[model samples]
Target: MPLADWLDRRTGWRSLAARARADLSRPVPRHVNALFALGTVAGTFLAVQVATGVLLLFHYRASADAAHGSLEALLSEVPSGWFVRSLHAWGAHLFVATLLLHMARVFVYGGYKRPRELTWILGSVLLLLGLGFAFTGSVLPWDQRAYWATTVGTRMAEAAPLVGEELLRLVRGGEEVGEATLGRMFALHVAVLPLALLPVLGAHLWLVRRLGVSTLEDADVEERVGHARLCEGGEPFFPHHVLQEAFVANLALGLLFLLAILAPAGLGPRADPLETPPGVRPEWYFLPVYQLQKYMPRSLLGIEGNTLGFLASIPPVLLLLALPFLDRSPARAPSRRKGAMALGLLVLGLGGALGVLGYLSNRTVQAFGRTFVFDDRGFPERAAGPATEPR
Candidate 1:
């Protein structure tokens, strides 16, 4: 009776291990394709983000006055801090990309039907929380880019019709983006949002296990006969599906590392409320919405375009949440579900188009082998120089 063996038997350690092993070894649909691997890729980067974020918090200062200085110091003075920070930054991009792909896969494969509706709802919530992480993280550096980007970004919330003003105040922590705002964003990035994400993520994963993977071959049949009858045979989750997931995870990490090293995250000048950057852009993922707000006519039907756009954005989210109910057709085949497929395509196309337009609308100008930024109104502004504290 070794001490380790005694503990394993006395505690639930052995049974817990057995149960986990069994869970991983559960059967998966034979038609579960490579797209399913996107979930693993997203989860991998999420773990990286959390790990690097914790390391960063060791040196981070969350105040508006000190936040940019702290980041500059972290890059210059702390050993390996630059690389870790770069990993975390790039991991955010990778996580968002993979998560989108995962959701698209689920949508295209008709995986969000019947008993799995709650799983889809939970995942949709995670998507919004993921974007929250991106928005809050963008403001943490407290640099010129961060300050103006956040200032402009939060302004969109002020278009929420009746509650817009209150929403803007709630987000900014006051009348403007300053000390109070920085504190709120920092708390959200490091504590509040992460705490909220954990339980929802756990429930999503548990639902996947409880219901099993959806199959394409019998989608049409299952829609009518129910998913239980379609689960006739498949491969085990371990070794087979897990190996594919492992491969995708490794590929995602490799790409993240390459980007981190080649184009490491750079800190910019500290935020100055008195000065505005020439061209401030929100993170790429938010570019579509930003572009829409920027280019859309100021007035639509005598209403403010910003308010109209803000209200318009609400329906798509509601539509996604209501997808399982709306798409009640008992056929999962793409050809059979023409309306759903068409709508998915339109959404995807519009997002891609808006992203391109956002990039094109940026007012970056080149001169003397150096790039200079300008305000959206085309006024000349100072360049955000190298990642170093000014003497």
Candidate 2:
């Protein structure tokens, strides 16, 4: 108590605490429930990732020759190193998942309209950056999956119209995914991307603070000069809202540890440039796009399939970036925005279906008391009987 008093006298701890409490006590919409705390959940996972990543970095090697071995050493030779590494790996996937869910929640509420436009833009950028983190982090291990997945990803990059080759070379840091490529991915994963994300995240939070949380009642409406729509007749955010966020955060943390303990991240064989593994694939998030490519012809209407796919994706992305501007309906209710919601649902449903098929590629699976074989293109044919399990 004496030390606490002295510290408070010297550092103004009491004032700081008071200020924090006051800031957090601001009123938020009564409807801002635990579902609205997904962004906070995402931020928590990002913190977990950064902390665990720093611990892993102490033992990690960035070169192709030593990278996989270093990870093995970390898992086997170091104290609680497996926990740290597992948390880092598991946290990355959870981070991406939470970010996607947060975006979906925002979409459902039409949280991208009007004055929150810039916030939505920053969020979209954060989504891409999150995916970048996943890809580059995957390549850091320099294991079989990492190597082959990176190879697939880089080859896919070559589908870009004019700058494809240049982008591929830049990404790989050379002609192929060798030591230089590993080094580049390491730098991007640990340094460049983190630095990029921090500022964007800061700006995003600042915008959230400046504008306050968007509620269902005001998303697509024009801002009025004197009206305070954000917090009108709302509940205090400190106890009511913060408690919900804390609860969700704890649940998410529990899930992360459960996953780490039950199924820790494992490395495959060290990367072999001479050997290509069977059934190599990218992460689940990219599976839909990759699986779509498998179903398409090599060339379509005088255009390469890859190039056409790349071209087709640009319009959606452009449209997404310009959504707040384009969808100016002045109505946020889902019923009024039926067409937009329907389109979004269709895309999400299709992507989920494709991702499921991608995971079952050319393999026989049993479900609902039946067996079916999925082709490389993800189409299913009825199996003769239940497939035998491989030893």
Candidate 3:
């Protein structure tokens, strides 16, 4: 048989299987839940970011010397380029925000327990990967601000005690940022990270299928047993939920395109290798981590260490990774899991507090005339001089 004919023959069977599975796994609740809606919203934004990123790649140039100028030209010259870039930028933020919200909902609702633990763990990895995507993409603009901000970022990494120097060298591809660094970052941002995420994401969805969607405690599962009983049986995945997902996805795509057309991204001047810019900051997603680095004591246990900084970051990282295991209660309702509920609130409170303190530290440093300002070449223009001329 011709391939087309074979595919056509299989379509009906495929649809039937999908419908059967959906009917079996559908929520027992009569009303659609808000958590379900929120996940859909987040999934929509993720699709937008992926699509826009691909479009932007068509116009992006990777060379450090030309990358910044090319981005500027794309904004000014390409038709509707500004809107596309802005949508891409804003979409990134939206994606992170929505994912965070989704995770919170899952945590509070006891969605991470027992059979669903793997799903939650995979989702956490996805969150970290999303963050990596954001950080790598941020530096591609190659503006003075972007360059020096990344410099400070890498230095913070290098501050790790024993292994820090090696790790920094691996990230930078050398002692300093240059073409190699840009190329490596771009590769990781576009190629490596995506490749790494794909299998994990597939596994996550598979687990969702195997374990099934979580439900509020009040819903009875026995009611959702039959296939043909429309009122009692779950809706068909194809015409019901799948169609809804499609509609939401297309709506998100439309909005992203509209944004891209209305306001393309703007680019700063080309990064000069010789100078640095003042008040350089990272993308908003990194604000918490960046802030944490500031408040952590320079040393711990009198060991004389930046090791403390490295160690300080470990808890949050581990907590995020270990959430699936940490939340092992049998209860699946937010109200029932008091310990998890309290922990979630504590994490949020700490994050907010640390962010505020970090911001205050920056302000204090600037007030004391100790903050490093950068020149156009992305090098720090030192504030404290040799104190030589007075003699």
lDDT digits (tens) for residues 256-354 of candidate 2: 999998899998898999999988888998888777776656888888888887776677667667888888776777888998899789879988988
Error of 2 at 208 (Å): 0.9
Highest-TM-score candidate: 2
1 or 2, greater by TM-score: 2
In candidate 1, which residue ranges exceed 4 Å CA deviation?
A: 217-220, 223-233, 300-302, 364-391
Q: What lDDT would candidate 3 get against the real structure?
A: 0.71
Cα error, residue 230 of model 3, in Å, equals 16
**Each prediction's TM-score versus the true structure:** 0.89, 0.92, 0.80
Between candidates 2 and 3, the TM-score winner = 2
**Shift in Å, residue 197, candidate 2:** 0.5
> Could you give candidate 3's per-residue lDDT for residues 1-391 as a string of tens digits?
5885688697766677767775555543343344455566767777777887898899899998888877888888998777768987878877788788888878777777766777888999998998888888888889887787778777777877777889888888888877888898899999999999889878987786655556554222322532123234545444575666567656766766676566556677677768776566666666666766665565677744456666777798789778868765567767777887888899889877655544443331232435544342233456553333332
Regions of model 3 farther than 4 Å from truth? 1-6, 9-32, 218-264, 359-391
lDDT of 1 by residue, 275-319 (tens): 997767788899877766665568888888889888777887898
Give the TM-score (vs. native) of candidate 3. 0.80
